[model samples]
Target: MEILDLGLDILTWAAILIGCFFVIITGYGLLRFPDLYSRIHAGGMADTLASFLILGGLALQSGLTLVTVKLIFIIAFLFITSPTATYALAQATFVAGLKPRVDEGQLDDTPPTDKVEGGKD
Candidate 1:
């Protein structure tokens, strides 16, 4: 095998390893994170990145096979659906009037009902 082929193999393995790492980190984040929003963020970030990495590595390994086409399809589905799921979750939180963390950056414009009415029910 050529040096270039060896390099590609190394990269493919690296991508797969990193994909596993993302999955593990997300699992840990789900257990360790303080709040729902933060946990959601971690889950989304890890899932998206891991999908990218795994699909990329699979594509590399698949070369010109039908597996590559299937991997591409999987990646496309993931890319389309993950963001939509995350957006729906965030919208649900917002519409449900979930409060953002105080340390969370750049909050929305909607004022809380308690703040406006001066004494929550």
Candidate 2:
């Protein structure tokens, strides 16, 4: 029983750590990415994954409890809503004539260059 509990604790901590790492990366991406579309993509995807991982870790640590149930419900809600929200935002922006910046000249066989349009090299 003790060994089982120890394993569970380790798993819980690992999940939480990974989740936190994703959150950091998301923040960096939100800052580093150019254009609203890119920022939205990074924030939407990474935020959802991080929330799931963190909440799942908490649910595992809590075991069969009300907290776990609540966390599960929250995760479910996020799973349904995050992508939908992202799509809606993108659609609205597109309808409002906010086009994503695409370098059409670079669409061919040439490799990407180190020079970013609005970022440091």
Candidate 3:
């Protein structure tokens, strides 16, 4: 039982440390990314991953308990909503005429066939 406790502690801490590292990287990307799209991508992906890691770590520490169950629910909610929210935000920005920054060879020169006009489909 003592060994098992120690092992759980180590695993929990490892997950927490990794999650913290991702959170730091996300902050850096949000600050330094060249474009809104890149920033959004970093923020969304990192936020979801970090939340999962951190909450999973906490769940592990809590063992089989109500707190762990609640954390799992929160993780699931974030997993579902983060990407959807990011897509919605990006879509809204595009519809509002905020064009993404394009780089050379990133896309073809051809214009989009379905153009959004006045935020309409």
In model 1, where is the ten-residue run with the lowest total lDDT?
111-120
lDDT to native, each model: 0.79, 0.81, 0.83
Q: Candidate 3: minimum summed lDDT over ten consecutive residues — where?
A: 107-116
Model 1 residue 85 CA deviation in Å: 1.0
Model 2: per-residue Cα lDDT over 57-97, one tens digit each: 99998889899999999999989988888888888777666
RMSD of each: 7.0, 7.3, 5.8
lDDT score, candidate 3, position 58: 96
Tell me how candidate 3 scores on lDDT: 0.83
User: What lDDT score goes with residue 114 in model 3?
Assistant: 49
Question: Which ranges of candidate 1 are over 4 A from the true structure?
Answer: 2-4, 104-121
Model 1 vs. true fold: TM? 0.76
* Rank list by TM-score: 3, 2, 1
Clashes of 1: 0
Candidate 1: RMSD over Cα atoms? 7.0
Kindly list the per-residue Cα lDDT of model 1 for residues 41-94, writing each as its tens digit.
888966588989988998997789999998888888888998899998887776
Residue 62, candidate 1: Cα error in Å is 1.3
Worst 10 residues of 2 by lDDT: 112-121
